[model samples]
Target: MRPFAVNRIPRWISGAVLVLWAFCVVYPVFWSIMGSLKDNQQFFNGKAWALPKFPLLWSNFSYTWETYHFGRYFVNSIVVTVGSMALALLLSATTGYVLARYTFKGSGLLYYFYISSLMIPAILTLVPMFFLFDTLHLTNSLTGLILLYAIGALPFGIFVIMGFFKSLPRELSESATMDGASHYGVFLRIMLPLAMPGLITVSIVNALSFWNEYPLALILMNDPGRYTLPVGLAVMQGEMQYRTEWGPLFAGLFISMVPILLLYAIFQSRINEGLVAGAVK
Candidate 1:
């Protein structure tokens, strides 16, 4: 038999495919950054593929911050994201710990019931949620938004943290118990520290979800001052008119994305570690 080339396809074709994938992922970020430097005239008249001839970053950033009152929106987003994540972490950590460490009647049934909630579409519950929140006068408040976000985030956080907690060694807790540590002490000093990566992962996931939340925020918060970034940005459009104010719009969007991106960059290793830890055991 003649010698066969195992790789028959051209290397350049594979390279081209990889390049295309990379471009697909990064092109939007690049375009947004470039658009933030272009004037209204240049944004439309100039080629979208081309970079700005004159970068007006300072003016664009200033306009986006001032006109959109993005500072206030940013603070609101931070508060909501942080508060929701805190609540999510607390609830998830406790739930996961209980499910993992104990063997009680109906434990499996309870876990199944909790996980089943994730199957239902969040939009389906919006009416009931809104009615409940309205009844409590939680409508149009930051606390209401945080509470709503935390509730929505709970299922996934509990699921993810449950996997991590289940993967943990029971021997550690056994040792803690031998040393006379109580259930609360073992959880607080041992389990929690060991599960830090999972907690951080839950926090990041909940924060991102809360930051990008719109539908609930739209219904709950009527005040413009309490608007998160997504809501504030949506209001920037004027009466079905497509204004070519790409500079400020892009600047606002770019700024809005920075915190989450930075967070992912900083804690990416921990996220990966938690994922691998969960997957292995």
Candidate 2:
């Protein structure tokens, strides 16, 4: 076989595989959105892939928002996701800075400890965490959920941020210190802004994870009113099984997807830059 022909074979195979993977991921999403525009009878009686009839049922989204209390759940998810990201970013940035910049006693041990936490499956800790939170009267509360997400996400955040911080030249911090900058000033003015790429990447990653997280949210949020979007959607699905409002169910799923999609769309460049820089460094 010609050298070019041999090389083209793998390229073609890889391209085909990627196209198939893309279809697998995107087709269901497209189907859900289309199905959301349909009504129960059309969705069930008509072909699964058929387009909605003229004058789409846009009301399904409204019904989901008002009738099913998804509005409350949506707000709860926003609050929890934002709060968790803020808390996690703060903790990760500070801890990562210390680990990267200073050679304090046991700092290596501490850094490894954080990294080690990432190895353990979160499911293993769920029961113990639930009991601990219950003791603190934090169960079924948004605040508790936020804290849990922050803590759960911390290990990976620190790992990513620390790598970025470590890649920076020591002279940057030293020069800032010589120019009458305090440790706080250097960190706040110099390091933090410089580390924006990593922080953005971490925030986007954690946002997606927290937004889609279901099992822990299900376990923590016992009150119907406290449900986040994922938990709320699951509960709504269960309730709708008998009622079989497929359109509204798919509508709820689409609504839950909007924020995260918008988030990724906005920060996609930053995420790519961060990952590339991290990998290069």
Candidate 3:
């Protein structure tokens, strides 16, 4: 048998493509970080690509946090994202487990309904949702925003988790049941742990979406003090029309992205695992 030989040209081409893609992703984030360290003059004086000025203005972050109430907005974002993600995971896991394991008459119908919802554009529901929330006296409330975020994430979460649950061997549940484990016990103890990769993947995806969500948050949170980070950033940009504090604005934007970056970095391995699992199974 002949040994395989390296394809140098194709390898070089692939390397170049990857390098370009990395640059495209990294440069904007790098620029934003550097911009946040400089003052407005440096940011606007066609020096965005230039080295930041000496004595970096790290105070820009503080100004953004204190003057613009970015701290409050940041807290609000954390609360909403965490709360919504927790609710979404619980609901999706339970629903996905039942759909994957059971043979009830309407189970297939319900699963398809969730799958179909992914096709419906969320914007189409805005007006009706607004009226519904208003009628429920939930508009302008963090709880309302949290509920909306969780519900919005449910379809995708269920889809992902259902695949994982279905991929597991039937013997696992059967053995647990033979040992006198209740359905709830089999799920909570045996199945949920096995589904960790999918849960982590869904959590990261939903967290990023909830963290960066702007439109629904803007409409729901009327009080300035209740605004999430994205809405606060928009308000900050609007203020920039009068006074161009580009540095601090970029600082706020950079801050907004850090949590998501950190989240992906931490769960990146599980993300890959979940994707591969879904694909293979």
Which numbered prediction scores highest in lDDT against the true structure? 2
Model 3: CA > 4 A from native: 1-17, 44-46, 272-281
**Given candidate 2, what's the lDDT at residue 147?**
92
lDDT of candidate model 3 versus the reference: 0.89
Between prediction 2 and prediction 3, the one with superior TM-score is 2
lDDT of 2 by residue, 1-281 (tens): 65664577899999999999999999999999999999988977899889999799999999999999999999999999999999999999999999989999999999889888777998997899889989999999899999989988888788889988988889999998999999999999999999887888988888888999998998988998999999999999999757889999999999999998898789888766655543442
- Residue by residue across 1-281, what tens digits does model 3's lDDT show? 66668698997999999999999999999999998889877866855599788899999999998998999999999999999999999999999999999999999899889888878998888888888889999988899999999999888888889988999999999999999999999999999999887898888878878999988887778899899999999999999889889889989998898898898798888766554544452
Clashes of each: 0, 0, 0
Name the regions of candidate 1 deviating beyond 4 angstroms.
1-5, 238-244, 269-281
Cα lDDT, model 2, residue 140: 91
lDDT of 3 at 85: 92
Residue lDDT tens for model 1, 1-281? 77856465775688899999999999999999888888878867888888888545568888889877988899999999999889888888898889988989998998888878877998887789889888999887999888878878776777888877888998999999999999999999999999887788778766766888888887777788998999888877552166557788888888789998897798887656654543453
Candidate lDDT (C-alpha), each: 0.82, 0.89, 0.89
The most accurate candidate by TM-score is 2
Candidate 2: worst-modelled 10 consecutive residues by lDDT: 272-281
Residue 200, candidate 3: alpha-carbon lDDT = 84
